[model samples]
Target: MSFAISSNDVRIEERDGHTYLIASSRDEDGNYNHTELNLDECLGNNEGSFNWSGEGFTGSAENIHLSIEGPEQLPILRAHLRDSEGNTHDRDVNLSERIVNDNGCLVFQ
Candidate 1:
């Protein structure tokens, strides 16, 4: 499929207390730096706009069934983002919480 840059922000889905990361970008090789951006990098210590700082996530999505194993302490999240053409990108993310909250939100540090 052809790759296209998405001008939209990432999306999150919360269901039965579990949170899922969803974006226009798909999770695949050759799409990381090209399409995906980490939570810290996306937030950029409060520089870039993952669009999360203000408006937050804005897209319709479904729960991700894939099991994402995280570190024991201060887990680093590997969130997947999608491109305009639906190519997935994986982003290594760090959330603000010391321990992950119920909904698995990617709040940058």
Candidate 2:
């Protein structure tokens, strides 16, 4: 399993006062996999944290933390994942540029 995630693989989306965090990855063979976390549902708020596990680039995230940073107040998520192969990954997803629009409304404040 060579799955990996970076800032570029993360996205934040807002819809009807709800927020979501999404991460995606593509393998060398062009297989795409994604995980979507509803912030309000999983973490209880817009800027919150949660844990997840999946397949292919499958892994588990623990001690997940989310926060806002910089003058623009962008969302940031920090977590460590252990792949199925037992490889560990530490990632800080700066969600500033990865914010996506949902139904023509996407804002983080």
Candidate 3:
């Protein structure tokens, strides 16, 4: 009974007119688990960092945490996820900067 979260699983989506930062992962039973966040208040115009720590619904996971931050001004990718085994894996760069552009802005073409 061991599960964990990854920083690479972070994604920005707009649902119900709300921009949420959804961190997705699988639990010990291979069940999909997601943690949502309101990026509107979490991050501002300038750039900020955040940490989220929690366990899966099955409780068979480590208290994994994902840190979100951006606007490095130089493509400073700093997203890393610590697995249940305590291994820190690096995520994509500039993944957090897209939130400002994708928050409430959509295109129809």
- TM-score leader: 2
Candidate 2, position 60, lDDT: 51
RMSD of each: 15.9, 13.8, 16.6
lDDT of 2 by residue, 44-72 (tens): 21122233221111125444665666655
Candidates in order, TM-scores: namely 0.30, 0.39, 0.29
lDDT tens readout by residue for model 3, 1-109 = 0111222255555555444556554444555555565643433221122222221211221222334443332222233444456554543333333332222221111
Clashes of 2: 0
Ranking by TM-score: 2, 1, 3
Q: What does candidate 1 score on TM?
A: 0.30
Model 1 misplaced stretches (Cα beyond 4 Å):
1-51, 54-72, 97-109
Residue-wise C-alpha lDDT for candidate 1, range 8-85, written one tens digit per residue:
234444544345444444333423221322332232211221234422222311222222233432233444444455
Give the per-residue Cα lDDT of candidate 3 at 108. 13
60, model 2: CA deviation in Å?
A: 1.3
lDDT of 3 at 100: 26
Query: Candidate 3 lDDT (Cα, whole model)?
Result: 0.35
